[model samples]
Target: MHDDRHAPRKGAIPTHALKAAQEIVVLKWRRTSFKRLDGSIDVLDDDWSLSIGGRSLARIYLLNGGPQDGRWAWFVQVFPEGTPGNGGVGVDDDGRAAREACESLLPPAIQQALADGRKSETN
Candidate 1:
């Protein structure tokens, strides 16, 4: 709804900020490899995924170019479906916000895990 929270990725589904069932939100993050212009693979530090129970739910990345270069972006996906468009673009600041913003789209376990002092470590 807000222009600042646009997902912008192709196949990104439009979602109305809903929290998924709590138990279904045991999320994890995994680093991703990117193919460089020279065809070399680079494991980026600013790009990673948001997973639930080891399955990918979305990706959080830093924009490489354009007016918003260096801004963090949220790329969400629903299994057997597509991605989320502008679901949580600029929810927070422009950097590292997706990591927090995307939480609203999923279960409350993320916060609960924190509250319980059991935050999942990045893998």
Candidate 2:
């Protein structure tokens, strides 16, 4: 992951410090494909804050899954408000894979928070 601790990375929006968020929402689920994938795990959590990291990562309402490479798959749209690449759909065999993939695309600071092993109330 790119380190931009001193400088704010473009499209990288920081949330209201995980320590301060209240009333956060957490969602987790999985989807299976009879065609190709066995299943995929997904986890999404976000605070009431409208900020990038504060909002839920899974945009299931906007998800549109289909075959991407001869294999049937579902895509969970994440970080809709972030820069084009900073946040986008994460494709995986299951929800967890998809969630981790999307989480990997988060801003550097958020990623660091995750690395630091901080637990939010939502978690």
Task: Give the local distance difference test score of model 2.
Answer: 0.39
Root mean square deviation (Cα) for candidate 2: 11.7
- Per-residue lDDT of candidate 2, residues 23-113 (tens digit): 3333223222123365663433321111334344333222344554332123323343333332554445554455566556654544544
The weakest ten consecutive residues by lDDT in model 1 span: 13-22
**The best candidate in terms of lDDT:** 1
For candidate 2, report its TM-score.
Answer: 0.35
Off by over 4 Å in 2: 1-54, 57-86, 118-123
Residue pairs in steric clash, candidate 2?
39-93, 40-93, 40-94, 40-95, 41-94, 41-95, 41-96, 42-95, 42-96
lDDT tens per residue, model 1, 14-67: 232223323443434668776799999999887787654434566787877877
Per the 3 Å backbone cut-off, how many clashing residue pairs does candidate 2 have? 9
Query: Residue 9 CA error for candidate 2 (Å)?
Result: 12
